[model samples]
Target: MASYQMLVKDVIKRADILLEVIDARFPDETRNNEVERDVARSKKPLIIVLNKCDLVSKEKLEETKSRLSKIAPTVFVSGKNRFGTTMLRHKILETAGIKGREILVGSLGYPNTGKSSVINGVAGKHKTGTSPISGYTKVLQLVNAGSRIMFIDTPGVIPFGENDEYIQGLLSVKDATSLKDPIGVAMKIIEKLCAENKTALESFYHITIGGQDSYDALILIGKQCNFLKKKGEVDDTRAAVRIINDWQKGLLVI
Candidate 1:
C-alpha cells in the first residue's frame, strides 16, 4: 500500500486536469476508487477516455458509453490504430474550456489498457515505452502535447487491499488478473459475465453456465478450453488467463 501511494496518490494529486482512461470493453472495471478519490480531492475537470474501442463489440461499447455518460464526458479512442482519437482531443479541449490554462492532464487507466500507447499516439511519435507487461510505467511521466496541454501519465492501478465494492467492480470489468492469482480472478469474471451478460456469453461460447456456481463454471470453462496441467488437473491460472483474454478481446461474446 505504501508503494502504491507513491504512484497513485502522488501522481493523481498533482494533475490539474484528469483524463481517466478505461478499456472501453469493460466500463464496470474503470470505476476505480483511487481515481474517484483523486477526482474528488482535486475537483478538477475530468474527461473519460474509453481507450481500445476497436477490440470491444459495438453493443458492449454502447453499453459502456451509456454507463459512463453519468460520470463525465467520455470518448472512445483506439490508441493503437488512432481511431476516434481526434474526437477525444476535441472533447478534452471542450471539457477543459481552459483558455491559456496550464492544464495537467493525467492519462489514467488499469494495466495493459493502453495509456502509454495513447499518449505516444497523441504526441505523434514514440514517447513512453508501451509493452504487454503490467505496471511498466512505474513513475509519473509528463508528455508535451503542444501548448496548453501538458499530459501527466501514471502507472496502472490494480487494487491490492481487501474487498472494497468499487475495487471489486473495477477488478471485474478491467480484467485486473495480474493483481491476484489469474485462475481465481478468471473464476470471478466468468461468474459475473454469466449473470450480467447472458447474450454476450452465448454469442461467444453458445452455452449458458448461469445455473452453476462461479467456481464450478470456472472449472467447466477450464475443461472446455483445455486449461489443464500434466496430470490432467485444472490449471486455474492458465484457464483464468484464457477466459480473461477472451473476454477482454470480445471473443467470448457468445
Candidate 2:
C-alpha cells in the first residue's frame, strides 16, 4: 500500500476522483488528514464509502452517513460481506459522470479498515491481499475494474504527521478499541455498559453491576467473565481480554 502523502501528490498529478473507504463502525478513526488533504488539495469530487456497516448499529450508521453527507455523498457498504458494494460503484459512476472514462478511485483507510477487501469485492476476485491483521497492504496497487474504472489501493493511514484530525476522528468515532492502555479501555467499556445495558452486563458477569463501584465491578466482572487467575485473583489481562472480546463481538455496543 502506498502512503497517503505519496498518493496525495500523485492524485494531484494524475487522478480525477477520490473514493475514501471508511469503516462505518469506526468512521471517526478512518477519516483522517490524508483523505482531507488529498481531497482538499486535489479539488476532486470525493465519494466517501462507509465500509463495515454490518458491525455497527443502524441508528449510528445513519447518523454517520448524514454527517458525511454534508461534504460528499456517502454510501454504506460492508466490504467483507459485499453489502452495498454495487451501489457504491454506481454512485461512483454517477458522481464522476464518466461511465466510460478512465477514472482513478483512491481506496484509503486506517489499519484493519478493509481497503483491500473493498478492492477485491469491486474487482470480483481476491486480487489484492487481505488479512485479519492490520496494515497488510504495504504498497499502492492499481486494480482494473472493467473498462472505465480503476481502483487504487493505498496503505493504511499512519496516525503520525499531517493527518491528526482524521486520526482523532477515527479513534473517537468507533468504540474505544485501540486505547493501548487496555485497563483504561476495559474500565470505560464496563462503566458504559453498566449504565447502558445492565442486563447484558449482568448476564456476562453473573452479578448485578448497575450501581457497583467501577473497581468492584471490574473484579466481579473478572471473576464471572473469566478474567480470573488460577489463584482466583482478579487478572487485568483476563479482564481486558473479556472486555475486548465483548466489544469486538458487539455485546458492548453502547
For model 2 the TM-score comes to 0.73
Kindly report which residue stretches of model 2 are placed more than 4 angstroms away from their true locations once superposed: 1-4, 125-138, 160-180, 188-220, 230-232, 246-254
Worst 10 residues of 2 by lDDT: 128-137
The residue pairs found clashing in candidate 1 are 200-253, 200-254, 201-254, 202-254, 203-254, 204-253, 204-254
Using alpha carbons, what is the TM-score of model 1? 0.69
Tell me the tens digit of each residue's lDDT in model 1 across 75-173: 788889988866766777777788866666766667666787777667664233322222334655677765466677666655434644324433344
Q: C-alpha displacement of 102 in model 1, angstroms?
A: 5.3
Q: In candidate 1, which residue ranges exceed 4 Å CA deviation?
A: 1-14, 100-102, 125-139, 157-159, 162-182, 206-210, 222-241, 245-250
TM agreement with the true structure for every prediction:
0.69, 0.73
Report the CA-based lDDT of candidate 1 relative to the real structure: 0.66
Candidate 2's displacement at residue 147, Å, is: 4.7
